[model samples]
Target chain A: MGFELETADHPERLRRVAIDPLSRVEGHGKVSILLDDDDRVRQVRLHIVEFRGFEKFIQGRPYWEVPVMVQRLCGICPVSHHLAASKAMDVIVGAGQLTETAEKLRRLMHYGQILQSHALHFFHLASPDLLFGFDSELSRRNIVGIAAAHPETAKRGILLRKFGQEVICATAGKRVHGTGSVPGGVNKSLTAAECDFLLADSARMIDWSLAAVQLIKQLHRQNPALYDNFANFRANSMSLVAHDGSLDLYHGQLRVRDADGKLLFDRVDYQAYGQLIAEGVKPWSYMKFPYLVGLGEERGWYRVGPLARVQNCDRIGTPLAEAERQEFLAYAGENGRSGPLHATLAYHWARMIEMLFAAETIAALLADPALQGDQLTTSGQRVAEGVGVIEAPRGTLIHHYRVDDDDLVSVANLIVSTTHNNQAMNSAVREVAKTYLDGRRLTEGLLNHIEVAIRAFDPCLSCATHALGQMPLEVLLYDAGGAIVGRLCRASGGGLSS
Target chain B: MSDVFLLDGEQVPFTVGQTVMAAARAAGRYIPHLCWHPEFQPHGSCRLCTVKADGHFAAACTLAARPGMTVDNRTAELDDQRRTLLQMLFVEGNHFCPSCEKSGACKLQATAYELKMMTPHFDHFFPDRAVDASHPDLLLDFNRCILCELCVRASRDADGKNVFAITGRGIKSHLIVNSPSGRLADTAMSLADRAASVCPVGVILAKGRGFVIPIGERRYDRQQIGAAEEQ
Candidate 1:
């Protein structure tokens, strides 16, 4: 860990750190932390340079195309956008309650989406950091590192993600950008053959998901102090829960709980989410800071995603996941949901639990004959406005749309899950900067500590804003007066430059 | 109709009045086309059926099938030009196939695949085309219009309704409804009209009946464009 500093000759400047291409996350991002001459961390901000104006561009599109068109938001979790947009259209078309087949098919697709997306993040993206030390040599801290060092885990992860994709292909008609979910109902139901094929593969997926849960747990147990304290913070948790107060990723009322797992608000209809959630804009990043209106913007900032969903839900629906939940609850002692999630790294554990639950749910849906039913759609009196909310793999996703009498979308407001966790991610980055980089030497591997905190949230900055291009991981050091005093660039091909 | 021509070195016979495309069709060959439907008079707007006839580029749908004339139909160069033409049509309009109801059944998509077109190879127009949903049973999404004028031919020549017409020229050319309100609902183009199903793309659609045909089972799902043309 040595400096390859190229200075701009500002002798009075101490140092400034900027992490460009926040490596191994969902999309392109940069984190700039400014240190003053007093060696104090002056400012730490996460910058999303791309401006994603999807909500604005989607205006005037036919409500039906919204499901498929909105998939451009994030390649990883396009299904979340697809389904959220579809749910919104269901209301626009006056499809109050979907046919049994339609709802089951949609649920199946969603579970597959969560199962695949979570598996991808845990095994492909985050495992590199978790398996290898965050400060390990750059070459050995990616999915390749996991594959070389831990072959069985890598194989399991790959197989789990593939099976989840197969499930999606069967339900949605295509693995990528499937047009299954329409305005009123799903386009097609699963054939008996498709259902049986997924059933044959379900047990393996379940076993692999359980293994993932065990793997994360083992890692947590090995370093309890580090796992519990890394980027740990107190904030409100939000997610969608079923009518019975159980985990329901597809559709339900909003439930928000504090850090102690005490209910701040539960069973709040998401249609009135505007009354509860307010977005704050900062010129630095394109990502919006969404906070609860009741607490106001200052203290209203909350966390969503695996940690929040696990913390906020009363219980999971499936038997296997419910059992795992019991073991996870032990970590929080009597409270169960509160303390365990405060450890940001525990998101991996919660994510695996959800993946297992998704697998279990997929199996149950395959066995149900409703998937083979012919009643795929139903319609009633049309409405001019509709709201859809779903717990996407990332977190709670909200989509509100208003259409003219001609059924063309007149207005669209989308609150992506990644944007919801923007403030929390910034806080985590600030904590890492203070803890690791304030008075210490700025080195290559040490910078990854900040990225580790962000990876825990699995934040899709592409959804927060957008871009995905592989370039040198640049750290541009600036002076107090905003001149580039020093610079270090970690090239994408595993070389360093100054 | 038995006037014979050497088409790609194969002898293809045609009627005295038949064009190269009609002759190829009768002889169990396929000349990729968009605007030249068999049921209507050939209007060579979309140059998808371009071919080398006697060492000169010609529209196969309009070129007369003269006896003993050499023609190159499926040569590499001709297919390349067809691919370029298809790419141009694709970029000139908003032709997103993912959510389109006519995705698997569209002639433009089928022709592009048959020509082995990998990409549009041009920046998209991102055209802000109008969507008219005034009709109770039909939806007119103008975004995907390729200006092929099949509906125009079908309405004027076959259905006698004159419900649709192509107005303007070149990039500014657009399809319009022949109604006082200039809306599809204001016209008498019902589901039974020949113009209703004559669209080669998703410009006209039935309301409340999209995505009913599963993607894999649509017309071009299993059958390629060439095979469908031959049939």
Candidate 2:
């Protein structure tokens, strides 16, 4: 993409550079880079200008509506929100332990959901950036362009996503916004036909997922210096881990580790998450910043998602993915067995590994005779307040709720995955901005750099804001006097303007 | 008392004082209505049952059946008008189907599907309506109310509690609780009351039981409303 510069809005007094509607990302958001008279970058902020009040408005409603209601947050990863909310309601209904069949069905739905979402993000959205250089021509750098150049790769991505959707349909009923999982258990389990349908493609999907990881690793090897150093920094990490300390995406205790791989907290009950984490808000952005309460806001801000989860967890649950995780930890002959990988670009590799795990998990769940069991739900003593935490494809997603005696939800607190990574994304964008600043204004290369940095986390602004809007890249530069000096915008349709 | 009328070419038998809606239902026919319930007196509020009775536009829920009379129930022209009525009901109020607990079993949603209503075809009024969840055993979501008076009629007639009523006119029309505090908790309504489950839509529902019946197993889930004996 190229832009023709014009001082139309602010004459020769260049003050601000903004990338409005950041492109190839999930939702509408922009980057504002405040500059000084010396043309030096001052402050950079990623803002969720749209306000979505799902937290406030969710109150005074019946508790069962939650699992389906919250899916309105994001189309990409709705199953995560659905499962997280359902888990919270399970606690509300006093079903602390679910029947084996119910748990298996829910797990199957989740794996299908994460598999499809990761495939869509890696292939449909982020692949163009990797296949073509970040600074490649706008017209020639997109999914369509990639399809023209590498048809087999593009087809694999589509088929992989399709297989995931089919699994969701079998378990949840329909793909997007399905009502499969209820408070105590899922509505239904995988039928014989459904099991057959999924099993037919399980081996193929695992193969494709392996290929994707290999592809990203090869891409990283081509330019390790840029891949490793670009927008890289040391940061703390967090995710959910199984009781045995294996990678658990569906359910587990909360764990947090620092940059040097020091365990700050392990096996913290998610119900006590309120004591461990506190949320911070700024006036500019609607999205909130969440940090470990012990560390406070500024120092506690850490990274989450694929990168964070891989570094935080001890091992992957599935054998194939576990092997890849080991290889990834030893990248470039560096022993990461006892450390965290700080490269943001490694998120792609981590995501593909997770996808492989999901595929393998799907195969295991289908073979279980529990899919045909009659024990579908369970109940115990009820609780007024409940909290649910799951490792969403992005990272730790927390949903807490309190119900009145009447059973209407009185309080709701949702720390979405993207909200947890808010500070990390802002810092990543800032690092890219500083490195790619050529002179007075942002070039196409700088804009692409910012996009590539943000896209790795796969941030969903709609989910972050809990509102709806467009997504593309735009940067605004404002002088110290607060007047906007220069601006660059990339529309969602890949049109660049200045 | 026994009378026969031709409804959309089928012979429908009726008794004295029976409305077209009653006669049709008694004879295994479904006449769509928002305000009429089987166990209550007809209020004829929502005119979703608009029909051509002997070549005159009439509400089937209120129109008395007469022998040797012809009534057109599901004609294209009448359905067009009925669709417009349903559309107005939809856009005027918040009828979010996917998230509503009453989604799979709601008659308003089922009838809309029966009529093949593709879209609302008008700008949404989006009238502000507040939820009344004050009652421990009940939740009143007025946002989905079509002003059908099924709850109103059941409360006043069957339950003899007079716990509900409708006020205002035209677009300002709304459902109100017949209590000093204007909340269901203050009324005599209980989980056992017939008024509690009379809502043809999602307006009056019991607390803590949302989505208890999974979607696929709900009343209208497996078959179209028309194919079923009743909504």
Candidate 3:
């Protein structure tokens, strides 16, 4: 359950620390830290314990069913899976290009998914830590506590999430496991009444979403040191960008940027992802480490999701969000230049910005006359293999499928957003542990701080691990002799014990 | 006077020799079931409707109701057993709900939802079943067949065509077409036939008609099977 690290002063001695069942993110994971005899942190590993073989079991199903089936991989972001798989199927069916109505409806669903998912992560999950101090009373560090302390903010968060869910239901058919999107195209379209329903509260949603950006800005400004250096490790960034180099979550070409904000790759097709992106496996974790193909194992690790998306994209398509993005980039530093933002805490700010973008995009799509078109699907000649990629709320998600002559899925490989950020999350954890955990007495707050670093990425272990049940995080510290010196465990129901 | 049985403390009236499942359905009470259709003879397959009558366990679909007999259909123990049985059915075949066109309306899925079965619990059998798309109007995805025999009974008793029957045994047992060519296209099976809609899962579906009703508005989307049946 633990590893050993040797120090120069004590060649024969080793130290170990472990965090089991990492809590608050979605699904089970743990962290192991190895410290030298001199108390210097040597190594950190984030271990994902659960596995659901979506890739293996999906092999024999019909290609048309891949979209609906693969979506079961993650409950929190099923829309992402639904859309990604649908797009892949679109290619398989030789309908790579969708009808105007079909494309707009899918776009609406994708934006709604991002809005709701980001709202849940910020309001329900991370708000407790941000609003209250990391070491605040465990009882008072949750959405309920947020409601008690700041009712309007909590209410706004809930309503915003409700609006997003409503959008999902209106477009996709249900909030959870919807079947609106099908191979070649979507099966349904938004009626004028549904569009009107979203438009009724469109103004309020946009305003609240903008206010979320302000709130996060205030949090960051209030605690610069904590937010800036919490897990400040430089890494590459990746996202999908429109042909005009604008932010596009549902459809876009691939783009990657190095830590210095220099473009590593741009406008590349996702079908060629293997040529530019490679996955590395370690013995300690079930999650694979994906890095830039040429950067090698050590330096190739890159970050994805909100922070990366915000940093890698040139501009937001919607006007309101575009203005907010300009202000956000200026505040984050190096005016008028595009580059990766290394601060891990910036993810919350970026997430708020994306939520605003999603709201604005929803408004724009609703106003479009093409959205009401009667055409919903187009059939074409079937193909054997296809790839689909989209920016899920978490980050870039890819679904690749290969079918036999019978049109049964012979292979399925999914690269979820969390898996793309696996290495970076572990690196961030190590950075935080080394900076905060000085080999002194470990406190509950210290353990939570390490968790804070991972939460910043908003990693969805449920999607990554494909496992069921709650994730209860536990942390253990071992001395030079590899004996347990300290322990902190967080249960699934928001209770922490030592 | 009609005979009455005590079901979970409620008095449910039933005709003599009527099965517990029929009695429960007549009384607007839902005993989770598959393979036993109202118009068809009880087949006693898919033991999901197992209930405790007095002290013995029996399939509610076939267990004849007795006057004043106390039947336990909604007990925790029965629910747990039902969940395990549902899990076995799930892993025994590839019942991928997310991808199924009949997902929300599927009886197997609705029953599982009613019983609160979360994970499959057991390893997937991943059986290499055939997808019979030979029929011009209907699609038969054998991978999703739960062996409920609803189609078999409906075809024989209601449609009088004997178009579908069960062949093989144990894990290998599956629904088969009765046509000389063993293909749905060669059979007299029509979309209008009761057998066409008798499947409890995604095994039989209309071709080019997937997701026509959309997802959220499907049969069991908002309401569980128990409530949906009442409507």
Task: Give per-residue CA lDDT, model 3, range A165-282, as digits (tens).
Answer: 8888888888877888888888888778888889999889999999999999889888888876678878888999999899999998999888898998999999888888888887
Cα deviation at A224, candidate 2, in Å, is 1.0
True contacts kept of each: 0.47, 0.53, 0.50
Top DockQ model: 1
Model 1 residue A395 CA deviation in Å: 0.5
**TM-score, ranked from best to worst:** 1, 2, 3
Candidate ordering by lDDT (highest first): 1, 3, 2
Off by over 4 Å in 3: A1-12, A334-339, A464-473, A488-498, B1-99, B107-139, B143-164, B168-173, B177-200, B206-209, B216-231
Give the docking tier of candidate 1: medium
Candidate 1: lDDT over CA atoms? 0.84
Q: In model 1, which runs have C-alpha deviations exceeding 4 angstroms? A: A1-15, A334-340, A464-471, B1-4, B54-57, B66-69, B122-128
Q: Write the per-residue lDDT of candidate 2 for residues A1-498, one digit (tens) a residue.
A: 000121123433446666776777777777766555666555667777667789898897788888999878878788998999999999998998999999988899899988998998899888988888888888768778889999999999999999999988888778888888888887777668879878989999999999998999899889888888787867888899998889889998988998888999999999999898998888778888888999887678788888877767888878999999888888834633346777788899899989999999988888888986777777788789999898888888999999877777899999988899888888787777667763545586767788799899988877733221225556665665766566667666668787
lDDT of candidate 2 over B1-231, digit per residue (tens):
598999999999989888899899888888767777777777776888888988898889889988889999988998888899999989999999989988889889999998999999999988778889888778999999988888877888888999998899877889999999999889889999998988888888887666667657788898877666463
The residue pairs found clashing in candidate 3 are A14-A480, A16-A478, A18-A476, A19-A475, A20-A474, A21-A472, A21-A473, A22-A473, A261-A339
Docking class of 2: medium
**Measured with DockQ on alpha carbons, how good is candidate 1?**
0.57
Say what the interface RMSD of candidate 3 is: 2.8
On lDDT, the candidate that comes out on top is: 1
- The deviation in Å at residue A66 for candidate 1 is 1.0
